[model samples]
Target chain A: MSAVKQFIPLFDRILVSRAVAAAKTKGGIMLPESSQKKLNEGVVVSCGPGAVDADGDVIPVSVSVGDKVLLPEYGGTKLNLDDEEYLLIRDSEILGKFVKVTSE
Target chain B: MSAVKQFIPLFDRILVSRAVAAAKTKGGIMLPESSQKKLNEGVVVSCGPGAVDADGDVIPVSVSVGDKVLLPEYGGTKLNLDDEEYLLIRDSEILGKFVKVTSE
Candidate 1:
């Protein structure tokens, strides 16, 4: 992770490291790694400021570094750095972000 | 075409009627209709004012009504009106507009 800090994405592009799949299901049944369903979730490692509009004004990216976001099923440039795989995608391609809720 | 004037697209969306495939090649060799390749080109019938940005400012669409534009091979909602087929697509999805070049 330390080496990843040196890189920065450009122009509304986001760098994401996919979350690891759960070994067990909600029912507590252990599943093999191969059988585990690949989750479309990831954490934002790096993100650009935003895309520029026709007028040259910047349209800032909605998500920031450390945000947990939902990814599309496909699409995104795959990258490998120091044996770790990462996905580079446009900020608009992100479906949504996961928000944590706390009871009062 | 007059009936098409009654309908208007909304919000960066453009209503396009695809161009007909040419029955003859540029070389002037005649071909059957079934043998002609489908063209990814269309004429804009109607267009939206523009899409609103996050700040609520309207970002006007680039293309105008009657503009000859290139279309993507896929994506876009299909519509049927007055026995004619039209496609509803976002302005951003358009690849580019065709310009007529005339020698002075």
Candidate 2:
């Protein structure tokens, strides 16, 4: 079974996989894996449909799958699946998303 | 000026006044002021129009003015208005409402 199908988040919850440190920078600067600084970032692995409002309306989540997002230092429930660690957090708890800058 | 008119909570927020200790119980038992037990209770003073949903619909608050409610041990923004202390909290933060029981 696929990892995504193993468990599904509910009610505006999101499953995120923390970003791993890269050995090289985007500018081609080489750095040792141990020397690479870990950032509070993650990619949206899966997300719930959204939370229901008092009027029974579905409030869609702002982030989508494969989106890179910035996470808080704390909060979110940690989960272990297939020996990999992930975080399940509410959509509202997410700080923001990282938008790619394209220079024309 | 009336206390209620002084400040109006907005967006599902409620203004509450903590219940004061009474010298006597509802069962007519007499108790000294110092011996009276304080409870995690409050009376709703004012409520906001309600929070707006994604569709711009207003979700009415569950508790109304003069409604007795159970409060959490902590939370709610404290305010001192005209020498009186009050708590401003979201309606969702309230644990539950105390309904008056009537005997036929």
Candidate 3:
């Protein structure tokens, strides 16, 4: 892991990198690059303490770093850092942590 | 309200309509159409029963239909029905439910 990926998430923010396309369609759509559209699935690089609840208490996010998370395709801000595009999304926005399946 | 918007949610899926652009920048990027990119801030159209938890029980999502939700920009499959693009996102993928504010 690089030093940039070693930072801790703050509040409820999570550091994520878009998963490259597994394969492109025959039509050459190229699965819109991260610059063009929000890509799903990312390896959690960092996480925040938690989100504040209505009671003013901290509600910790369920997932942890190194987990592959699924999220909605429509939210989050796009940002570029170190020439690589990454997304800083809230943990609540994540749908679920995918369990890796190894071929039998 | 349209009849299509009156159906009940099934498992944990929430039907959503993309929130239209609040304001478009002059660059003509057009924020990538719903077909090109996943759009954020959808009005919940329907919901599902809930996700099955480790305990084998249903864990209902927090928000309800009519709720305006924020999502991660990077995840979700694109689909179009009846000539309208809509997102069927898992509630867990939703980041937060926006509380409409009435300014004085």
Judging by DockQ against the true structure, name the best candidate.
Answer: 3
- Candidate 3, residue B21: the lDDT equals 69
TM-score of decoy 1: 0.49
The worst-scoring run of ten residues by lDDT in candidate 2 chain B lies at B1-10
The better-scoring model by TM-score among 1 and 2 is 1
Report the CA-based lDDT of candidate 3 relative to the real structure.
0.66
The local lDDT score (0 to 100) that residue B101 gets in candidate 3 is 89
Q: Please say which candidate is ahead in lDDT: 1 or 3.
A: 1
Reference-based lDDT, residue B3, model 2: 22
Residue-by-residue lDDT tens digits, candidate 1, A1-104: 35434778888899999987789888999989797765777899999887887788787776779987767678899999778899999976665565554444
Candidate 3, CAPRI quality class derived from DockQ: incorrect
Summarize candidate 1's per-residue lDDT along B12-94 as a digit string, tens digits.
77889998788888999999978776579999987766666866476899999889999999987776655798887898999
lDDT of 3 at A45: 71
Of 1 and 3, the candidate ahead on TM-score is 1
DockQ of each: 0.02, 0.02, 0.03
- Which segments of candidate 2 are over 4 A away from where they belong? A1-4, A23-38, B1-104
Q: For residues A1-104, what per-residue lDDT tens digits would candidate 3 score against the true structure?
A: 65544456677788888886544566865654554544466787767887666556676666677887666567766667778887888765665555544443
TM-score of chain A of each: 0.86, 0.79, 0.68
